[model samples]
Target chain A: MSLFVQTLSFNYTKRSNILNDVSLSVAKGDVLCLLGPNGTGKTTLLRCILGILKINQGEIHIGGRAIRSLSARELAREVAYVPQATSTVFPYQVLDMVIMGRNPHLGLISTPSSRDEEIAREALTKTGILHLENCLFSEISGGERQLVLIARALAQQANLLILDEPTANLDFGNQARVLMIINDLARQGYSIFMTSHFPNQAFLVCNKVAIMNEGRILACGSPDEIITDSCLSDLYSSSIKVVSARILDKPHKEVKVCVPMLV
Target chain B: MVVAIFFTSFLFGRYPVTPDKVMAILISKIISVPKSWTDTMETVVLQVRFPRIVAALMVGGALSVSGAAYQSVFKNPLVSPAILGVSAGAGFGAALGMILYLPWVAVQLLAFVFALLAVAISLFISKIIGGSSMIVLVLGGMVISAFFQALISIAKYIADPLDTLPAITFWLMGGLSKVSNNDVIFAILPITISIAVLYLLRWQVNVLTVGDEEAAALGVNINRIRLVVVLCATLMTAAAVSISGIIGWVGLLIPHMARMIIGPNFQLLLPVSLLMGSGYLLLVDNIGRSAGSVEIPLGILTSLIGAPFFIFLLSKAKKGWS
Candidate 1:
């Protein structure tokens, strides 16, 4: 397993648990999409896995090494994180923002060297945003900013990438673009673990799907096996239909979509 | 530009020493040049103006760097060096020292100690309340600042209006006229060391501006880095305010100006703020002394010049920050 969790449980206070006994794993070259409704502890689970939140009881291992045994820098080298995009107070250049990924590799008093700049440039190229290198990060569009964040994570040089709502605020075209990039990274043998509200997105790129609700995983399997009409409808507490639709001029190909039916 | 301002500042006091005499007197220290200037001229230049000019540069540079670092660490562009109640605490200490009839050196020492004490109190309260979140620390600082300001008011209420009250009031107005060679030497070590430490951690400050959780995910030990930055910035602010009294606006305005010149990359912003702050205060000091018969206090002049210029910069630029 590229990433593994065993019986993880967490809570902010003793009165209630936010994530209860969650366990999952992702293999190399796999794209796992965690699906859940709002306020279902999906993000809390991700935080526990990233070591931001201490677990109440459980074990997490990255590449067979216990997470508690690794230092923060070591963890960063093993896993890269792409947080949701937000505006910054200062306007940093895209290249400068990307170069910040080299922080873990630097010493206490040292800055990034020229070789680190080369690595940042390579990450930018991989994300296909090399042309936006000189633009101010604040001046870019939201979708472009998301891509820049992904580039920054890639610059960490970690094989496992964890993203939180990577496609949340993007338009349809930008969503497709980001999903395609995720697919490409998985094809390049990188393990991807991401959380999303869109179940259709799991069908688009993810090979594995995990449904979480009220701090527990309801099911975990391949997308076709777990993302059913009943599972989503019950998970969302609404009526949802799973339908197969054929594309124009592509009758041989069909895709599954989740549609909500109003009373 | 800083060098030119440093040398030119020596020529513009009540004692009119010619530019050539200024150069001759400055060079005479190194080589054996015959003294063509009067004893009073030499005293005015070397003993009086030299220490004051050096104090301006050191205090200005230190305050600006501290402000820039605080702004980054707090992730708020409006943050100044006085955000943590250091200035208010120092002001109260200075007031109490004056009312107690302490000597000038003792007063400055008390101010430095109290400044650090105030920050410690703020940090302690923050730890108890919210465990190290920036907003909680800021609120803690606000409470401490208000408390210190009240203490200063009490000290003023009991002070002798004829003697101690005016002295306390003047000191609070801020100036460098009384700074001697010893005061400059005393403050130089802490100011220089703190600024050097901050300069080395410039890149980490950039990461800090990305917010706490994000910075930690990027492998930064957020608590350790925040503590170091806050300690260094407070030390520099305390030392500067102790020597020059509460000179305001340099801390808040110079960083914005530096950011305007070059965008907010601390790699360049730190050095730029240091140099610009030095030159700005020197020029302001020149105007303060030569523009009138009696030297105006630096705090008043800085506010006078800084407020209008800040407004102009804000109105002219589309966005002061990103």
Candidate 2:
């Protein structure tokens, strides 16, 4: 397994536990999408697994080694995180921002050399953003910024990738583009652990889906078995439906979509 | 450009030395040139102008690099080297030294020590107040600065109006007129060390700009790196203020100019800021020395010159950063 969590529980205060016995694992080349509603501790779980938040109970292991045993640099080399895209105060060029991912690979005093730049360029090219290499990050569109962040993660050269709401601020077409990129990365043998609000996104790219509700993993299995209409309704506290249909003029390929019902 | 300005500064002073004489004096120091230079010329070049020029360059470079480092670590472009109360603390210390009739070295030492103390207090208060949010740090700095500013007022109030008050006021205005070789030597150690530390850690500083959570996710020990960068910047700010007595604008202005020219990459921004800062201040100092019969103080001249130039740069630069 590339990333593992066992019986992880977390709480900011003694009275209210933010996460309770949450357990999940992702192996090499697998796509695990954590589906939940707002305030359901989805981000908390991701933070705990990333070692940003210390869990009060249980353990997290990256590549079978206890996460606590590794320094930040070591853990960063094992897993890469792509945060939601936000505008920066400084107008860092797209290339400059991507090269920051090489932080884990370089020494304390070492800077990104030509070799590192070459790697960053390759990552940008992989994400189809090589043309925006010189553009200021602040000037880029939200979807382009999201792609830039993924390129940054690719430059980290880690085997495991963690994404938080990768499609949150993007338009529908941009959202599909991001999902396609995530799916391609998984097919290329990178393990991905992602959190998303849209359950339908799970059917598109994720093989395994976990529905979280009220700080607990209510269901965990393949999307076909776990992401039913009722499970998503319970997870989000709303009426939702799961339906299968042909997408984009492809008759043989069936796609599943989860839509929130109107009251 | 900096080299051109540096040599040109030698010709503008009161005891005018021709460009050829300046070159001869400079080349004579390195190798065997004839003893054609006068003793007064030698003293003017070697003893007076050399130390003054060196002090201006060092102070300017130190402040600019310190400001850039602080802004990156704090994740606020509006922040300057003095944001943590270092200048106010140093100003109070210098005023107290004048009131006590202390020596020049004692004044410098006290200022440097209090500058560190002010930052330590700011950080401590922020820690006590709870989270490590940027707002808390900035607020803590404001409180500490106000505290030190009040202390400076007290020192000025009680000081002898005849001698100590004017001296304190003059020092507070900031100038390099009294900068001796000893002062330059003392400030160089801390300033150079801080600048080197910032330069070596410049790339890591970039990681810090993405904010705390992202920085930690990238495997940076945010607290440790912040402490180191803050300490190094504080040391440089303290050293620069101790020698030159709170010359403003170079720290805040040069980094922006550098960023406008080189973009936001600190590895390049830092070196560029250092060079631009030194050259800008050296040119300003030359103007201060020769502009009128009575020499203008550096503190007044930097903003008088820096503000308009910065505005011009802002107008010409692209609209990217908000």
Candidate 3:
């Protein structure tokens, strides 16, 4: 099953609407990349979907259950979210930090199970950071910490993984690596929904793209169909163009989410 | 670990008894052996030093656990029970109680109530400034701390200098003197129960440290969890400050020390903190009684020792532990 929101809307200050009549269906194993600039309600939409923010005028259904009807743990079992990167105050070891994802699956009386450790270890191994498991998270590099966050999400074992700015502070290699990881996970049957400022990254990784602007979806379609000069020009409110590119001098790249402007 | 602390305390008091004798006395006491009609060592083990030892253990565990919880709730590392003004405010109340010649139970309860009042005022001020945000709570804690310190100063200024002043001063310094079985039971029972309860929900505390929104996203009832944690933590803190009269650094330093040892999982950190805190307090108490005829206050001893050890640990470890 997949998650769907019907006419979702949220207002800030109970006056101006931040999300207006947002409707979307995320099918199983679908990677829906929400491309938007800052304050375009991308994070707000994610919060509404995760039940962190209340939807003012519409309903959100996850796995055929209403968002409000499901318990927090039950909802967590369905949707795992990776939040924006903020500094951790304490010097918690990586193992302890990742093990917190097992909380939703546990009973009130049970501690983290052996299965939880195996899952965390597998996630860490998959992310190629298992060697750093004993090290403190605060002392890790930004890229490694980003991977640790993904591993924590993987340990959650939810079907739908949501991430906000997963590669916000990463270098070029780590950004590509994070996108590659998400692409691989999607191919392996995990539904991924993420927001990103890098439109090209979304073009390289996402199967479907929805561009949002001013609290509204400007366009939603396949990358090649929606990543057009007209849409980019209107969404970013600037002159933009996407040209064909070559890989090894073979004219093959057709869908480029490129926005080259000198302003 | 508590058992380890209890045994160490029983064996290493001022009236020195062998570990073997301490163990034998403990076994006889538990097994109901016929009373040793003439052995003073047995009385020392069972009656005189045992209550003091138990009191220190409870106070240490209670204060440190409260510290851990408050640190997590406030999302601030430097916060302790005293930051919410409970400890200092309770000192003021206890000083007032002493001046009034109130009974011991009455004085203890009065101090405990005043501590609760102090925390309530902090909570109220946090609300007044749109709390549930980390910065606001931290500010509220600072304000409450300042307010209570001023009140304590007033009490000190007005209290009779000869009898009450000295008593009040020593009480604020924290000692295991005047410890009784009843006081131990009273102080420990609530704290033990609260610690157990908080331990069961320890992961929530770790989640809270992440943030309110992120924690809410993880399916925690953010407000409810925060409230429960704060109440349970402050309750134990009030109980502890009432009995021990404001032991300081155990609450501030023990959790961080335990984090260094076992990492920062609250599940492991909780038990380690309890054990280390109890053990350290008992050790300091032993040193205090042994060093001089006049027993040193446990608070002074902890600050005197913990501060230097903290600086030493900071210097030796060069990676991200400040």
Candidate 4:
């Protein structure tokens, strides 16, 4: 197993818990998608796994070692994060932005060597953005920025990638592109964990799916097992329909998609 | 440019010494040349001009680098060294020292201590309020600044009006005239050490500008790095303010100017700001002394000159990368 969590609980105040008894795991080369509505403790669970927030009760282990025992540098070398795109005040170059991922591998006073820069460039190329290496990051489109963020994670060279709302602000075409990248990364033997509101995205890319509702994981299984019409409707507190549909321009390769039914 | 300005400044003062005579006096210190220049010339060159020039350069570089460091750590391009209440705290300390009839060393020491205290209070306030957001820290700074400013006002209200009041007023307006070799020597160590520390950690500072969550995600110890950088920056600002009172605008403007010339990479920006700030302030000091018979205070002149030049640079400079 690349990541394992057990009975995780968190609370910001004395009034109520934000997350209670959430447990999940991801093995190498597995893509796990977390599906939930807003404020459903998806972000809280991710923060707990990242060790940004100390959990009140639970245990998290990466590669069989307890997460609490690992220093930030050691943890960072094992798991990389791709945050949702936000505008930076400074217009750092795309290459420079990617080069920042090398921070975990460097010493306190050390800087990125030419070799590190070469690796960053290689990551950018792998993400199909080599042409935009010298462009200002602020000038890039939302989809390109997402790709750049993935490139940065690649530069970290971590086995497990934790992405928060990777396709949140993207257009339809961009969403497809990002999901494709996640699937490709998973096939390359990397462990991928991501949160998304789009139910069909779970069907599209994830091999494993978890549906969270009211601060807890309501269900966890393969997409076909968990993303049923009744389960999604219960998770979202609204009527939903699961139907088979053809994606892309291909005549074959039909896939299941979830569509919300009006009240 | 700083060298050229330094030599040119030697010639432009009210008691004009010719360029060759200035050069001879400078060289005579290194080698035993004949006594061609008058004793008055030697005294003006060595005593009056030397310390003033050094003070201007040091204050300018220290303030600008501190401003740059603060801007990065706070992740706000608009922030300056004064954003943390250091200047207000130092001002209050200096006024209190003056009221107590303390020596110059006591005044400086009090200013440095109070400066650090003000930042500590701001951080403590932010912690008590319970958030890691930058806005909380800034709001805490503003509250602490107002508190210190009010204390400085009370000090001014109670000070003896005859000699001490004018002295206080003059010190507050900021000038290099009162700087002696001893003051320069005292301020240099802290300023130099702080700037050196800042330069060494420039890459880490760059990582910080991306914001706290991202910085922490990248494996940086955000709290530790920010505390160390803030301490060094506060030390430099307090040392600069101690000797020159509150010379504003240089800290706020010079870093912007440096960023305009070189992009916001701190490895280049920090060192470039040092050189650019030193040259700019030295030239401004020269203007203060030679522009009229009465020397204009540095605090007034920097704003007077800096504000318009900044507007002009804004018009002419490139967009947002800085």
Candidate 5:
């Protein structure tokens, strides 16, 4: 297992628990998508896994070492986090932005060397945006910026990647592009943990899916085994349907999609 | 360029010294050159001009570097070295010392101590109110600054009009006319060490501009780095203000100019701000002393020049900052 959490519980204050005994695991090459409605402790769980928030009870282990026993640098070597795309105050170049991933590897007083730049460039190439290396990050389009952030996470050289809504603000085409990259990274044997509001996206990319609601994990399994009409409708308190439909006439390709019905 | 400005500054004082004579006087100290200049001229060059020149450079570089570091750490381009109320506290301390008839060294000491106290109070208040978020810290600073400013007003109000009042008023205007060799030597230690520490941590400061959680995710210790930057900046700012008496614009303006030229890479920006700030204050001080028979206060002139030029820069360029 690349990541394992056991009976995790957390609360901001002592009164109300935000996460209640949530436990899950991600093994190598597994793309685990956490699906939940708004304000359902999905982001809270991610924060706990990233060690940004301390869990009130339970233990988290990454790469077989206890999270509490690892220093920030050692933990960064095991896991990388990709935050949602946002503008920066300073107009850093794309290469400079990506090279910041090498910070965990460098000494306190040291800067990124030529070797680090090479690694950043290689990551950029892997994300298919190497040509934006010299452009200002603020000058790029939204989709390119998303790719740049992914490149930065790739440059961190961690085996486990945790992303918070990687396609949250992107348009449809960019969403597809980001999803394809996520699928490709999982194929290359990296363990991915991501949260999404779109259940249709889970069927496209994620091998494992977990549905969370009101601080609890309702179900956890492979997407094909866990994603059903009634489970999603109960989780979101809306009428939804899961249907398999054929899109092509000549070879008869079928896909499962989650559709919400309006009253 | 800094060296050229440094040497050129010696020619513009009240008692004029020729260029070659200035060179011979400087070189004679190093080697053995014929002394053609009079004793009074040498005294003016060595005693008056030399200490003032060194003081100007040190104070200017210290203020600018601290300003750049503060801006990066706060992630706010508008922040200055006094963002945490160090200047206001130091100003009040100096005013109180002068009204009480303290010695010059004692005045500087009070100012430095009070500056640190003010920042400590601001941090305490911020932590009590809303943790260490940047907005609350800034608000805490603003409240403390206003409180110190009121204290300064009270100190000035109680002073004798004929004696202590004028002295406090002049000191508040901010000038290096009283900077002696001892003052320069006293301030150089903290200023140099602080600037050196900030320069060494320049790369880590860059990591901070990516925002707190992001920097932490990258394995940079966010709180530790913020604390180090705040301490170094406060130390250098307090030292500079203790000696120079609240010269303002160099801290706020010079870093922006450096960013405009170098595009905000702290590795280059910190050093560039230092050099530019040194040359800038040297020129400003030259103009202050020689541009008129009676010296204009440095604090007044910096605001006079810094305000208009800042407005012009804001209108002209929109690329360096977000």
Candidate 6:
């Protein structure tokens, strides 16, 4: 249950080098929080790993097999991706939206199997939205919408779940609820990989942390090992500040504040 | 439900043939048994009218199903068959073939080919400009539509005012007059096959509702599948248009009606739209033929009735979905 990135690279437009020779490995039962400054290619890296963006150089290997060696369908069976945000241009019921995750498992023309229905229901329940199954997608709150999207990825039944900015848009309470769900899923043996700017969040939940800057991995270690005063200060040299807080028995974190150092 | 509508509609047409009379007519026509078969009743019940009625039923269903498929792929409720320049391209191709003295089959085939070519060119242009962007895909459809309409206008100007002009006018307006047994034979095969393919692959269409990248991630090949679906939808719509001439409103109106009734799954929407489309067209065609001393063109009859009903539908639709 390890996700490996080997020589992964990507391009945007005709211009090359959005991601450059970036590689990392996440072990079984690990929550790897990808911490990066803005425009550090966090979302691009996720797309390349998911096979949505074709690699210009090298390969992504999942469990010792090249990503190119597996069919898109086969690879999708191994990985589930939740994007930053999605807007349903057409208004559809929440149940219908959640059931779209059953796409890979169901036949081209066939209805969702009873097993798919059961799995989808369980995913919804895990995300704490089984009661909101009948609600219209457009009528839901943004945090609820994000949970519903997570429920969709969970329904894919992949061993590795990749999320892009899972809590980028949410209140403090909602963000914690989302992070708690991810932590619970990791405990249930699903490998969680996500990107975050909130170093505090990574310190609380992720056992392994990778900090990125300008399309390169600047540091990769455990939260306490990778984050230091100089590294955190240089990471945000322009206007740096740290606010310490202890949630008593929960978790304590040194949060970075203000604009991050880009160079 | 499509089956139920087909039989029920047959029972309730202008000349209401009783179930017993329908049986007698079927038997007499099969054996050519000599009896006092009045020519008008015989022609109405068997020869001239039956094929036209069946053709309308099939073609109307084809267009509506095509529209539903397009709406899903384009991810826009406003998309229709004509929006992709498909209808206009096929119309112009058929008109040119008819004016040049081609046979009906050749004309229909040519029309189908050009209609597909129009969509292909638009797809390619979208790829070149805004690769895989939804707004780019729709804008490409709009440009292709306007370009084909300019061609249609040119074709109308060059035709003979007396002979070709009225013929083109009638064809452009759409009707059941040109429907023959050969046309029915020709039309139903491709139409049935395309609709069957659509029904078989309808669930893949659900992926499109979420957006393309999500669809591609789910082991779905977006480009390959889009090509096949567009070809099938275009084939059904083009063949239907070649026979019925540009029947307006069925493609535009029926998907909305069906979505309202059965929800948004193509499993239900496809069949329901098929039934509602032909039934609505049949009602309009009946009025076109039987309303007065002179027969009005079917398109005019449809629009005249369709416009008011559509406006009423529009006012109600605005408050609910958007």
RMSD of each: 1.3, 1.5, 2.4, 1.9, 1.4, 3.2
Docking verdict class for candidate 2: medium
Task: Write one digit per residue (lDDT tens) for candidate 3, span B36-81.
Answer: 4348897887787888898888888888888888887777778876
**Which tens-of-lDDT digit does each residue in A67-117 have in candidate 1?**
888877788888889989887888888999899888888876889999999
B57-92: candidate 1 lDDT, tens digit per residue: 999999999999998889888999999999999999
CAPRI classification of candidate 5 = medium
User: Which ranges of candidate 2 are over 4 A from the true structure?
Assistant: A246-252
Better of 4 and 6 by lDDT: 4
For model 4, residues B133-196, the per-residue Cα lDDT tens digits are: 6788899999999999999889899999997788788888888887888888989999999998
- Clashes by residue pair, model 3: none
- For model 5, give the interface RMSD: 1.3
iRMSD (Å) of candidate 3? Answer: 1.9
lDDT of 6 by residue, B1-322 (tens): 4455454444444665665555466579778665654566666666556787788788888989998888877787888888777887888887787678688777777777778788787888888998777677678878987888887788778888888778777778888876787888888988999999988888787676777777777767777677678878888898898888888878878887787766677777888888888887777776777777678888787778878887787776552275
Candidate 2, pairs of clashing residues: none
TM-score each candidate: 0.98, 0.97, 0.93, 0.96, 0.98, 0.91
Model 3 chain B poorest 10 in a row by lDDT: B29-38
Model 4 lDDT, residue B246, Cα: 88
Residues A79-132, model 6: lDDT tens digits: 888877667766667777777787777765787777887888889999999999
In candidate 3, what are the lDDT values of residues A1-263, reduced to their tens digit?
Answer: 56787888899677789998887777887888898767899999998988887788888988788988987878888888887666688777788778777767876545877888988899899888999999888888888888888888888888889999899999999988888899888988998888987778767888788888878887777777888888777777778887655665666645454857777
Q: Write the per-residue lDDT of candidate 2 for residues A114-134, one digit (tens) a residue.
A: 999999999999999999999
Off by over 4 Å in 5: A249-251, B320-322
The total of clashing pairs for model 5 equals: 0
What TM-score does candidate 3 reach? 0.93
Pairs that collide, model 5: none
Per-prediction DockQ: 0.66, 0.75, 0.54, 0.61, 0.72, 0.57
